[model samples]
Target: MKRSLDGFPKIEVNTQRKEGKALKKEFFRKERDLLGEEAIPENAYWGVHSKRARDNFPFSKKVPPSLVKAYFAVKWACARANLEVGLLEAKIGNAILKACEEGMEGKFNEEVIVPIFQGGAGTSLNMNINEIIANRALEILGYSKGNYQKINPFDHVNLSQSTNDTFMTAVKVATLWQLDELEKEIINLQETLQQKEKEFASVLKVGRTELQDAVPITLGMEFGAFAEAIARDRWRLWKSRERIKEVNLGGTAVGTGLNAHPEYIARAIVHLNEITGLPLAKAMNLFENTQNLDVFSEVSGLLRSLAVNLRKIANDLRLLSMGPRAGISEISLPALQEGSSIMPGKVNPVMCEYIEGIAIDVMGKDQAIAFSCSSGQLELNHLGPFIAAHILEMIEELKLGINAFTEKCLRGIRANQERCNELLEKSFALATCIVPYLGHERTSELVQECLREGKNFRDFLIEQKIFSEEELKNILNPLEISRPGIPGFGKVEVKRP
Candidate 1:
């Protein structure tokens, strides 16, 4: 095992080139000239990344999977887009597509070592993908790795594109893809709640006291509210998708389209859309697209909205399933893991707690993305790297949060019918249902008498002989009286028994 001068494990260099290969000699000369005595190894294209960035910002672990996916997605989209526009040859486009297929099939693992965080606003990530794809294509063609003569990273893999356009475009494409999955899950959760609502629509309980009766409501109404909130969020996400569709492809190198054929830009967009089946369009104004990252900010805001609703729903679940003995206990959540080491049968809302924490992280990432977008200056966005990192992080975190909330929290939640009935029977909140029939004055007097004399409102009315038992039962039918789906109402239909 070779070791660095500082005593750490040194990276080994492997090359397919034979001794005295012309390209290999040229690479060594360039390496020595670029890096001097402490030269970057001839085999390592990502030397700048490892030697500089790895030790400086050691906070994040290996590059996140989502960010990796985004990098590949951008490369794939750019290749196809360039091919369609005729800027890149069909063979190059085909090679990029092949590389993408291999990547999707898990070809590149940890072996292709490149740090996710680097300087130059994602230039390292761009080069990493280019090098990987070029090398992979070379293998397919029976050529040596890093042999640009056969498959050049700049001339072939990154043909007619720049980090500015490719990186930003890839971010948009990847985010849109994640949002598509998110929308589906959100819809599924909403439908689940709606189904629960329809199932629990009939059962009712007494209001004000066990002795006094009050208006009624079905259990489904409560769950339906949750469904509606999720649906609204889904709509917001759908609207945000449009913002991502307008990609910054073809805006090569500072959005000038300089040194790029007009046909190349148009063809790339067409090819990208054809390959991905995503509604991607060539940016109308390349300069603005490259310089402005407002679209990412818009997408982040929508994601924040989603995270906010997720937190709200999780909090509600925790409260609704608080206690089987002391809290609301109106619902029961499916217990997954043991909650305590010593306490027997203790099951905490662990899934909800996890989801809440994930949402908080997403919220924090949203702020970071917002700041990155604002940091962009003239001619080119300087914060593309951070924006991509933050948004990708947000996507993965939200995906996990949604899945856990659905499977662990929503799927496992059960209405505590017995507890709901017990609470409804003891609540005075149903008094508003009676004011229409008895007049406000009489209703107030009856409520005060019941409270002051420690008597049930229904019993007090019956004892005073103000209404017969049959009429009282008809008026205070808890099931029928609470039937008003809309909140803040006075009259409840008296169900004749």
Candidate 2:
């Protein structure tokens, strides 16, 4: 076997003809079955197929780092399983394990250069991983790069595995990793909203419906609703992991475990769970797992649901913090940066706007994932790469966007106490508070009367002598009106002339 001198391959210098000049360049000629004699960079660990893929899908720059690490974990587990079943040599398996361990520790991340938008049912991505790993393992064993005949990328690294099983398994693992972080971001956002809820608990405001005054509500209540919605999303996200935990790791090619030992199938999943620290299990029916990709659709639906919630929350923040002069101004968001060059002292809700845009993008990506996952043929889904890439992008975008909103906008939010009081005083919706004493008809009349005279509801009520000042104070208590479960509020004692 041709081996490196110091257990590591060094870049080789070669002469090439370029522009009729004798040019010296560093290259390595790696051969492949389909595309033979391709000149690769000498220092590159990836091989012919990876180069082809890089050239083919130049639009997508690279694969997600999480997926690359997850792929390495799958390979590491497979190597251990093969070695355990006496199918692989100890030296080769140990070297593969070392490379995978380094990969999991983020060592070879830069080498994961496969573009995410490739075809071939993820075969290109799998080959990219196999080539990088095999060449790196060859280096650790004192073998030269591209000496695959001796250290065989397919035979040694990808033994007992296929693109269908390993790639899907890695996608699931990567998604689980991303969801864990997303759940944290969701919880952080929820806690921040809850904190604001508590801070605004006593500040009363006029609630609106269809852009018209509806009833009395505390500023805390609105923020509390946002917190509750995020809390629900956090729970749903935690449960989403269970849906993807069942993997078809043992199902090769078409879910039959072809050319793979049955023992390897069973043991590989166990090792994967150990390596990934996720509660992954082999599917009860490998055929079903292999043929169907609806699990991604289901998870994407949950993410879509979350995106919808985030959009609503963001829009509410935007509307609530509309302006200091002519808008609702019930709440004020932190001034992130200068809003416009033309408008001085003006600040925009850029963080909320950013979150709104992210939510819209996530929803769109979810639609793409759902449609692509359904485009699977009989045996396998050709759109697995697209689905995986979209899902990971959604999770990452949500995580980053939620964290940014929490830190930049949510944490610094404050209630507009003066505005809340002014709007509440002018709103005739407070007539609903006295609806129990004087039925809906009389209350509506009072509301109409106050609106027609352009008089504030409190002033109108005091002018009518429906109740004395003390009685109005007791009747219009903000907490009493907005508190929950206070139905059948007996008649307020009215002292009339």
Q: lDDT of each structure?
A: 0.69, 0.87
Tell me the spans in candidate 1 whose CA falls farther than 4 Å from its real position. Answer: 1-33, 36-57, 64-67, 73-97, 109-112, 205-217, 468-497
Instruction: List model 1 lDDT by residue over 70-138, tens digit each.
Output: 566666766676666666667666876788667645567453355555568777667667777876776
**lDDT computed for candidate 2:** 0.87
Clash count for each candidate, listed in order shown: 10, 0
Please give the RMSD of candidate 1 to the true structure: 7.1
Judged by TM-score, which candidate is best? 2
lDDT of 1 at 371: 88
- Candidate 1's error at 213, in angstroms? 15
Model 1 clash pairs?
A: 81-268, 82-268, 84-267, 85-267, 85-268, 208-427, 215-482, 216-478, 216-481, 216-482
lDDT of 1: 0.69
